[model samples]
Target: MKTVSFLTKKLGFGLIWLLLGLGLFSCEPDPIEIDLPAHEPKLVIATQVFPAKYMVVQVSKSFSSLAGDGKEMNADTTFLKTLAVEHALVQINFNGQTETLKHVRNGFYVSRNIPQHFQQRYTLTVRDSVSGLECTAATEMLAPVNFEKLEPEVKRTEKDTTVTLHFTLADPGPERNFFLISLVGANRKNLLPKNKIGSFNAVQEQIILVNHGAFTNGKYEGKERLTLETSDTLLVSLSNISEPYYNYLQLYQKSGSLMNQLTGEPINLPTNIQNGYGFFSAHNPTAQVFKISER
Candidate 1:
């Protein structure tokens, strides 16, 4: 009876050991973590000086991604999440209240009606989503800066059947100045600071020519023209677009591999500001627009 009892205990111990081994092997391996490149999107905030109640912010996907980079990622979930503002407050009008700014979509912000005040102050308290994050950048709002004028220089070449438009120096002295242009019949609100257009400002002065993107034959077929406007000037924006008007800077121009979708990583843009789309930020600058005429 004693020997039988001992054998029973041994068998029970053996069963327990077997179960433990199976459980250990059946467990899944721990997930691996890899550091991903940051999108470093740029942010552009548009609001001209007084009664200056509203703003239009812009962001462009870098150029590298435009050429094909990420192969397995959902851009909306990852890349757009990095849109210029991290954690910040934008003061629209002088209600002395900070609760008015509403974040619209990924890159839009609107402020509800605020009590009107002359020369009212408005600014932003933004958080940078970069790894070296800086959240509180409360810019002291005073009034909108005055508008700068643009004197465009236009030239034409008979041999190449091409025309070039250039600009003389603008005297917007510091403080992040920009020139806004309207192409022909575009509305005032549709105007943007000019630098976002493709390929110009080389050699002599800031010059541009109608290209294939603007038309099938690389020349304006009366589709666009430009009108320059400024803040702190008159009550309206000087508008522009299409004598051979090309398309506006679109956010959807850059797309890459579905492989990036496989991972939750923000699609890494391969180039810096000069080569890629300048990030979506107040700092992503747009220069003045120039036009070309046939020689």
Candidate 2:
């Protein structure tokens, strides 16, 4: 009888151990679900000052991603028109003088005059008369970059012969410098089929263009070597950009990368506007035309 009791007790303990093992090793946790609160709308201002061009500022409001319905909203013309602020009082101050910008159409405000020189410091102020909200930003325009050499080298492959335009840029610096190299075809055609567009610059032309990339005076300060793969009649615009603009462009490039999306990284842009969201920057652009050989 004692042996039978002992065997029963051993069986009970084994079952308890098995149950405990299952509880410890085989149990799955319940997924966590967090409900985030909605976000508020903010004023967004954007502008870029370039040489020999009147300043144009775009004013708009940004909607919070969490405020809308479950369906994603597309930023169409109607949506854009709704966000546009047409009656904002925009002003620019420079050299102890202030000028009110004229509201053109949509949300764009244009200055009456062009930038005098590259070294002038300009201040931009935007006030929403309805909401009593104001935003201000400042930037100094840098001198335009001069290319030492721009020539094309042709290489014949088994499939096709390709031409690469080689560029040599000299950085004018005692201070840190940034540059943008923009290329546009005369006929408004793309250089390549799958060419990607670069970061946004407020400088716009009547014709469509493609930007190579934003470059900095890191190692190639004296004469940097750059190339563009093309065989079309291209217009190249090189601009010396302000530091804040440079920083913003760099942030944009990183945030726009596919790696950032793959890693689930938040792409929050760095804004230079005070009491607002967006950036106002200055740059000096010099353009030239390059004609490549016909294959």
What are the lDDT scores of the predictions, listed in order? 0.31, 0.58
What are the C-alpha RMSDs, in order, of all predicted structures? Answer: 20.1, 14.9
TM-scores of the candidates in the order shown: 0.31, 0.62
Model 2 lDDT per residue over 1-295, tens place:
0000112226778899778877898665575698845544456777755555677898876654333321223324565577778879999888888888889987899874855666788888998787666788887766666666665555776986454556766555565656666656522223333436433222221122212232354224222122334446666677766656666655554342221211111245666777676677766567877565553
Clashing pairs in 2: none
lDDT of 1: 0.31
Give the clash count for model 2: 0
Residue 161, candidate 1: Cα error in Å is 6.7
Query: What would the TM-score be for candidate 2 when compared with the true structure?
Result: 0.62
Least well predicted 10-residue stretch by lDDT in candidate 2: 256-265
